[model samples]
Target chain A: MDFFIQQIIQGIAMGSLYGLIAIGYVLIYNAWGVLNFAQGDMVMIGAFAILVTHIFWGLPIIPAFVVAIIICAIVGYFVELTSFRPLINSSNTRRLIATIGVGIFLRNLVRVIFGADPYPFPSIFGNTPVKIGELTIIPQNIWNTVIGFVLVFLLTVFLNNTRLGKSMRATAQDREAARLMGINVKQSMSLTFIIASVLGGFAGMLISPVYFVIPTLGTSLGNKGFSSALLGGITSNPGSMIGGITLGILEATSTNFSTSIQASVAYIVLFIVLIFLPNGLLGKKESRKV
Target chain B: MTLFNKVYKATRIWILLAVALTLPYWVPNNYYLQIFCLGMIFAILTLSLNILSGMTGLFSVGFIAFFGIGAYTSAILTTKLGFPVPLAMFLAGVLSSILSLTLSLPTMRLKGMYFAVATLAFGEIMYQLFLNWTAVTEGTKGIKGIPALELFGTSFRSYSKFYYVILVILILIIMLARNLISSRTGRAMLSIRENDIAAEAVGVNVPQYKMISFLISTFFAGIAGALYAHMVRYVSPESFVNAESAAVLAMMVVGGIGSIPGAIVGGIGLTVLPEFMRFLGNIRMVLYGASIVLIVIFAPRGLGGLIERIDNILSGKQSLGVQKKQQHIEGEE
Candidate 1:
């Protein structure tokens, strides 16, 4: 029973990380009806930014984190201006391909700079064991779980209460309408990318200690996060978070069967969800404009 | 058309065919020939994807799944069951198309990003099977030492011989693609691409055309996969990774989506470009990445589109119906 509890805790931690990445997908997806394929690379870039700032420059963890977010914000802005802006008037397929191109560029650029080897990320939270009754838990796992949920909560609050968030939401709902309403539609789109990129960077940094900071890390992690978003109502904020948590728990339980099952759990779940709940668990039915 | 124009068209086609046939004679080394073979294989992939995505507007992100299916099918058939290469290759295509039927049925209802994600899930599931199904796949060790192409006691052991085989297959695929694209079914598929709702209103069966495009695309991809397996004498999950699908999509896009010649040029150019810039080493991919962005931005229609523009100028025609339709696709919000 303790083992299962412990596994659930770990799963929640990992799932929360997936939640962060999924939120990033949802944000950009809401802004423009396109998935930012490069969002995963943003996570990788964020982790590397911290690696360079904290490890190489010898800065404290907090400062390093802040610097990484800032760097990612800049990256987000630049990516939008360069890859997406020029193709704004084109089809969604072209925009999607452009993001893919950016992803490949960023991933390979990291490979060129960092080499193809995995790098160990120093633990942000100390490796202390916490005991709750008969259960022993890693401090980082607890921190990850707590911080992840908090971020999700904070993001929800921000979206509901803040003017910027409302404006961003308005833009997502209808760009033409938002523009007509005198909202800075372009600014809102750029901010959406920025926020989404920051979330990706946060997820990357969060997972770096657990998983190796490797160039190829983005693809698998990104795929899982994308699945999480899909599993949760893709357009809903809390829905995706719940989806991420469910996926994490599912993964944790499946690990008991075999590694193969665990490895494919996300994809299997994705297939099932797509077939049964095309609008997703919490997503509203999409209305098409003829 | 004038007699002079007809003669010019025939001569131009014959000259291009002659060049393709006599490639080995003009090429410098076997290494270059090997590159050409790989280029042709990818061209088939690009063309197949182009049919589904460029023409049908399906936009699959997990196309390599079908390719891997075809490859594993051929590998298992030939090595384990003692099947002949030609028969195994044909069966590979048949098997992949059959498998696609299962997927296409469920996924046909999905549109845009939803469909892309479903295909991605399909790919990941396929990849997992390739890796975890150790009883047959050898669990990442991959299938190896497959027999080379042999037909009627004539062994195609040499690269040049293999080149001819691939060339013949490629030419047939191209011809078939040309015919299909110009057919009534092809026109129906194009109508769906332009506007599915509109196409449906016009009495075209959107779902049926989408399925036809998907099946045909998977069939060709499977055939290409079988060709790749025999050419390299190996099959591995690594070759069919999502990045490979992206690369092939890149080729199709760079070549000119929905254009047969575009798919061929994109496949061959992208494949050969990296090899030609061997000195750039790690930076080659970075440059490749930049080029995709640049090309899409500057030359939105891709290199194939550029060729059409040049051809129009030389022929003194403003633009053809095909080009006009392409503009409509781009111009549609």
Candidate 2:
């Protein structure tokens, strides 16, 4: 029972990280109908930004994070201006491939600057464990869970109640209809990118302490987040969150069996989910108008 | 086709064939021959991928996994089972085509992006299998000392000899691809790419064509993989990573999607050009990524489009506007 509880806690922590990245994915995908494959790279860049500020410049952790997120937003804007805006009228495949280029460029640029070694990330929660009776918990894991839920709740509310969020959703639903409704579709789309980048940056910051800072940090994590978003149904926020947690938990539990099982759990589960629940666990059935 | 066109085409083919056959002599060393072999191998890969991605419009990011499957299959057969290389390569392609069914069938109902992600999942799973299935794959240590090419009492143990084998295979595959693309089945596949629903409504059997496309593409990918395995005399999970898959896609795009000549040009150009840029050191990949973006933005039709324009000019025809208008109509479809 104790081991199971430990696994659950670990899963929740990791799932939250995946969830944050998924939210970014869902946002950009919704706004532009293009899966920004670079979203993962953005997360990696965000973490690197924090590394520069907090470690190199020796800024306080809070200021470092804030500055890093702003840098991420700026990067996101340029990403939109360059890779996306030029190809707006092109096919989705073209746009997606362009994003892939952006991802590779950013990753290599970071490698050029930082070299290809993993750096130790300083943990914000410090190296301490909280004890309760016979059970022990890492302070970082607990904070991660709490912060993850809070952000998800806040985002759900924001998307549900805010005007900008509503406009973003409108653009996602039907770009033409959204334009007809007098929405600044272009501006809305850029804002969607910035917000998504912020989320990606935040995910990066959150996971850095746990995963370390590396040039190739985003590849596997991005893949996991992508799978999470798909498993939850790319169209739904809550679904993405649930999907991440489920995937994380699955990975944690599977670790006991074999390393191979742990590594493959997310993909195998994603494959099964995609096959059986094409609409996703929380996604609506798509209606086509001929 | 006109008599002039026929004469021009025949002359071009003969000249290209003559150049290809005599390449090893004028080349400086075995190193250049090896690189040419590698380029031809990748050309085979890009061409096969084009059958699905370029012509059929299936955006499989996991296509390289099939290549890996073919390589490992051939390696195991030749090394462990003591089978000949040709027989092993054939079986490798057959196995990959069959395995492609497992992926294509379940994801048949998925839309473009979803299908892509599903294939991505399929790729990661395959990578894991290659990494962990140590019994067959030999794990991360990789399989080494595979047998070389020997057929009909001729030994292709040398690089120049091997080059002929690859060139012959590549030309045969290209001919097969060209013939297939100009056929009724190819037309049906193109229609599906333009719009699957519309094609289905018109009785094109969308799922069947998609399956056929997958089978055909993966079959060749497997063959290319077998070729690569034999060429290198080694097999490792590292050779078939997702990045390599992306590189092949870049080749298809750089040459021009949906163009046979484009795939060949893109494949060879991407492979050969990178070797020349070894002086750039670490920044090579960064430039590579940037080039893909620039090409997508500025040269959407890629080198294939440029080649067509050149061809038209040489043939005393004006086709620039006609080409653009055709593409526009196709986009509408």
Q: What is the TM-score of each candidate against the true structure?
A: 0.96, 0.96
Shift in Å, residue A270, candidate 2: 0.8
Per-residue CA lDDT of candidate 1, range B21-89, in tens?
899888999998889899999999888898898888888899999999998999999999999999999
What TM-score does prediction 1 earn?
0.96
Worst 10 residues of 1 chain A by lDDT: A88-97
Off by more than 4 A, model 2: B1-10, B319-333
Candidate 2 clash pair list: none
Candidate 1 wrong stretches, greater than 4 Å: B1-8, B318-333
Clashing residue pairs in candidate 1, if any? none
Can you write out model 2's per-residue Cα lDDT over B1-333, one digit (the tens) per residue?
466765776587787789999998998998877887898899999999989987788888888899999999999999999999999999999999999999999999987788888898898899989999999999899999989889999877888988988888889889988988899889888888888888888899899999999999999999999999999999999998887888888888888887788888998898988788889999998998898899989988878888877776545464445554434222221
| iRMSD value for model 2 | 2.1
TM-score of chain B of each: 0.93, 0.94
